[model samples]
Target: MSLHGIGLVFLAVLTGTASVLLAVALLRWWDRGPGRRGARLPQGLDGSLKPMVLLFRGQRLVDATPPARALLDRISAPESEWTRLLQWIGPRFPDAIDGLSRIGRAGRFECLGQSGTGSATLRLLVEQIDSDLLRITITDPQAEYAGIVVDSMSQQAMEEELDLLRRSLDQTPMLVWRQDAEERVTWANAAYLRKAEAQADEPIGWPLPRLLDSPRPVPGAGTRTRRASLTQNGAVFWYDCHSHPTGDQTMMFALPADAAVRAERSLREFVQTLTKTFADLPIGLAIFDRQRHLQLFNPALIDLTSLPTGFLTARPTLFDLLDKLRELRMVPEPKDFRSWRQQMSDLESAAATGHHVEEWSLPGGQTYRVTGRPHPDGAVAFLFEDITSEMSLTRRFRAEMTLGHSILDGLGDAVAVFGQDGQVIMSNRPYRELWPGAESLAEALACWQAGAEAGSGVAALGARLTQAETGLRDTGLMAGPQGQLLGWAVTKLGAGRQMVRFRLPDPAAAALADDKAMLASAG
Candidate 1:
């Protein structure tokens, strides 16, 4: 009973083992079979297996293998997948697209990739799959057969980085290009191509056209910049071209400089206008920089200071200019040399913070009004104005006024003059003595009315003095404050001025003066 039961268990175990072995063999075969998904590889140019394969139906992508899909994914273009693939291979195999159209009749075609595209070892095969379908197979014999393995993630990152770099270079606003040692343009970005097209009024092609002219004294080892201009449609555009040497080739970049150039031109024109204005000014103008060195001077400065034009043009310091003036006897003589230096220092300090004015009486009997003003950026401007004629006229007018006042004082009668506004403008010493504290015309009128006897015409006299009309006169007798007889007269002067005079009226004195004249005649 034990042998039979053990035999049955052993047979059951053996059947189970054979079934498991058969299942394992079938699974292995299925996994390694040609019918497995993505296991079929397209034939290469030499009839070897290639991993990269793509099928197209009249410009439409129908199917692609894993490596081909990865390559298409790596390429970035704003075009259909079939067009993108063509673009990716166009540089490597320029005739690949043309060969595909003829593949229907030829059945197959092969092309070797071109150099400079990093695909020289690549081989492309185009074959007719059906009446409307075409197949393309790209193979790199070295990479496919040489056991070269690449991490997919790393390759994807590298492709993205390359795409970003290409986008940045193409979209930048600045024009960029590369030239060989012979100054032949080798490469250019999209911006460069656009500018070249606009300038030429046509499309741009390979071996880019040169935009900026070659600078005088060719660029050397380091970066060099030159200003270049481009005229388009009757307008000039400016650019600052920067060139950098890279090995035997040179890299160039052009930045727009139109705004900067316009600003500089405006500044130059303004300076020229200012120079012309300064040249014609009568007052001597001297402008000093922050360092106190003379930066600008007008012709009047030379004429006024008697300074040599050569010396002023040499840009002398403030102190040096003062020293020259002192030597030429143009400046007022100082008490001592040390005091003069101190005075000069004080002048500079005052002029820097605020305005300073001084009067100089030269030895040649001429007077000058010198004004110093602070300017922006710690600069200073000095103006020298000749005021000799003005001073002389002022002195002459003052002397005439003094002489007139003396003549008025010498009069025996008390005299006071009133303006049209009824304000006392002039008064002699006698008038002041007669009417003490009577300064204005109203006060004088009040004093005369107080002293005058009743019905003495003082009110009438005041009305006459206040009238607007000129060339009128009035005379009368009034009693003084002491009861003494006084004679008064008011005569209108020109420009609405009135002159009033008062005198002591003595008939006895008049008779005495007549008898004395008779006695002297008898003697």
Candidate 2:
């Protein structure tokens, strides 16, 4: 190499390096133009900045900043433009820019300018470096940042909701599975895997058919099957599986088909068991709500209430049973069903109270005793027992008992009142009518009256009279003896407390006939 040639080479290299450095400096200086020149926010700043495509070139403005979501919402014009047709009618943009007529000079924004109806405020900030490649930040009046606070709260709430859903479904002893839009498994709770014998380590990314039995997949098409489930081994199970597009793919889930079948079987068994049990029960049972609405009733209830055919008592809504209650339910003497409105009010006021048993005498001469208990949710269970036979017997006994009092007033015959024992108590009206009133019956029977209240005398008379009047005792009838019309006068008032009245001739014979009539009335 000669010295002269080396010097020339060095000189050319130096010139090229200088040119490159100068170009780099110019570019850096251009980028700083906006910042160095104290580019300040415009007065009364209201964000209305929008990027516009220059009409001179076939180009588009693109933004992929401030999170992908916000950027997309900004650039993609809605199908129906935000601008009105009337605004574009009388000259647009450039004509409306205040200072620059025929040329829009409103900083860096696309806007309706003045003559536009419902004119709004707008501001623009141009961000450019070097020649022209630019990004214009558009600030619209309605735009507001949903800052970190909202984002944090939203994320927390979503996490809690998902956690709760997971816990609820987990406790259910059933397998569950979920798939993503790509048909890949996104979630499968523990039960889903445990319930399935052949669950894979992870069910993600497998084709939809791969999770099931061998099946063909047609692009963009879907199909289902009931073959040997991929998740279960040695278990012949059916799954209702389907897919729906989520985002780029579909999400799918598999639920046990047997669960539904089992539920149906159980419901059927329960209904059958209840029908048998209800028919065997002697007491009628009808359940009603606080509103006096009947819910459940046995066959006896139907017989007693004369319920209609094809009545589904199990599902009777409260209002439905009101009609039935109005028919069969009744109240005893002095208290009728019509006055029972207060009972319903009090039952609903307090929770779970044991109320008094109510009785009713039906127009058909039948007696129905009703008792009710409140259920946990304010529903009441009403039990009705037919006691017509019992009540009839009781009333007859009372009538026969007072008959002695009727004769004691004046019978014109020899009469003796015993205190249920053989001890003579009173001579009665016939004696009082013949010998005049003597010691009161209670005083005369002194010793016998001592135990009369509790039937001590009553038991004694049964034994004493049994021996005295064999014929009368056999027929539960007794009249004065020494006369065909009368064997020995005897009467019984009660088992616990006894009163006996004896009469002669007509009174005794009349009493025997009355006794027969009383017993018949009781039945």
Candidate 3:
């Protein structure tokens, strides 16, 4: 009876084992679907690929492969939670999280290893495995395997990077500051503190305008650069400010530019002064720089040169200006066109040393006194003055003198002009014949005195002339050439001058007059 009972228990155990084997075979056949027939699945039954296969349900990590667990441990993540995994690798997989929430539900991302380690990049693929499940597969597309280990020095490296950025901000010459979304300053560099002259009591919460009068608008969501000014220590200062926006904050940098601003202002003032001085000048003035380009010209220069204001404003070169002047016939005419340019070149060379000066007679019957003088800093200046009226007057005076000489020479009487110093200044042809060897009025008088019988010659006449008053006239006889007696008369002229005239004797008339006088006396 005991054996039969044991046989029945063994038979029952054998039937249960056959039913379990048949159920296992059916489940295996169902798991091998047609979609997974050609898909390359990872080999190795020891769960080596398990860490790389993550299963998610309702955005939660329900299960993970062995590779994924190894990766999370290498990244030094806190727990096996989905949030912790995303946080661990979010910096490297920025686009993956966004794509996971979208329809179609397929995304790719790059997974980087920890800092300070040589680790190969992992290509991560996420796709919907079912309606309520997602599968994440990590693979090395380049087939280069590397250990995904987190370096122990990652925290130290991050701290060092932050310290380096802070030192850079402090050493930079530009003033740098950080502001929060509420427009409240949160951080400022050493340069900012120095430029603002901030006291120890001042904190980051201080108003921006109080440190330096900032007039620019607050930066929005982009980058911008602008110029601004402030008054410090009773002096105006300039700066070039730039801004960059972060997620919820903005960074600003202000560089000093006061020197450039002041220099530009001084140049403008100097140009204004020069313009005023040139405005009042009567003579034509033109100035050229070292490059031979015209830099300045006065109004007189435009009028005298007859060049258009637009042409001058275009800043023509010196050669171009002269060429235009020549075309207008405003300058002196040259013998040859080619030679004229060469002459201009020579003039420029000579003017460099301030040794060029000339008179230009234009075709318009105008005369100009042109002078070229060297100016400071390798510059040149040209001056033009109209002298036409003065030259015309001189010509007219010479012509008058010639006509007066011709009238005096045609007279029958001998005439001589004397100055206040008793020097013979002018004489006609007749006077020259009478006193051929006399060099001066004093010499001629000396000859007459030598030829005189007593005091009746030029000596007596000279004495009488000296005693005569202004506007007085006197007549006398003087020994002429060939021992002939000539009637001489003296008349005082204005401006300390005297005129002397000599006349020939009428012998026949005098003798007739004498005979008549004798007959009258006898009767």
Query: For this target, which candidate reaches the highest TM-score against the unseen true structure?
Result: 1
TM-score of each: 0.63, 0.37, 0.47
lDDT of candidate 1 over 296-390, digit per residue (tens): 99999998999999999999999999999999998888999999999889888988889999999998899999889999999999999999999
RMSD of each: 16.7, 20.2, 20.6
Model 3, runs deviating above 4 Å: 1-277, 280-282, 436-454, 464-473, 504-523
Angstrom error at residue 14, model 3: 74
Of 1 and 2, the candidate ranking higher by lDDT:
1
lDDT of prediction 2? 0.50
Ranking by lDDT: 1, 3, 2
Candidate 3 structure, TM-score to reference: 0.47
- Cα displacement (angstroms), candidate 2, residue 470, comes to 29
Best model number under lDDT: 1
Query: What 10-residue stretch in candidate 1 is worst by lDDT?
Result: 146-155
CA deviation > 4 Å runs, candidate 1 = 1-173, 214-221, 467-473, 479-486, 491-496, 503-523
lDDT of 3 by residue, 1-523 (tens): 6999999999999999999999998766666768555553343333333225678887677888655665555555565467766765565556666766672544343343333222334455777767877777655444422222112223333554577888898999878887776666678888877765543345444655335433344445366777887666677778888777776777777888888888999999999998999888878999899998899999999888899999999999989998999999997889998999998998888887875898899999999988898999989988988889988998899999999999999887888888777778888998888777665657877766766655555765776555554443388787775778888887778777878888866667789999999999999
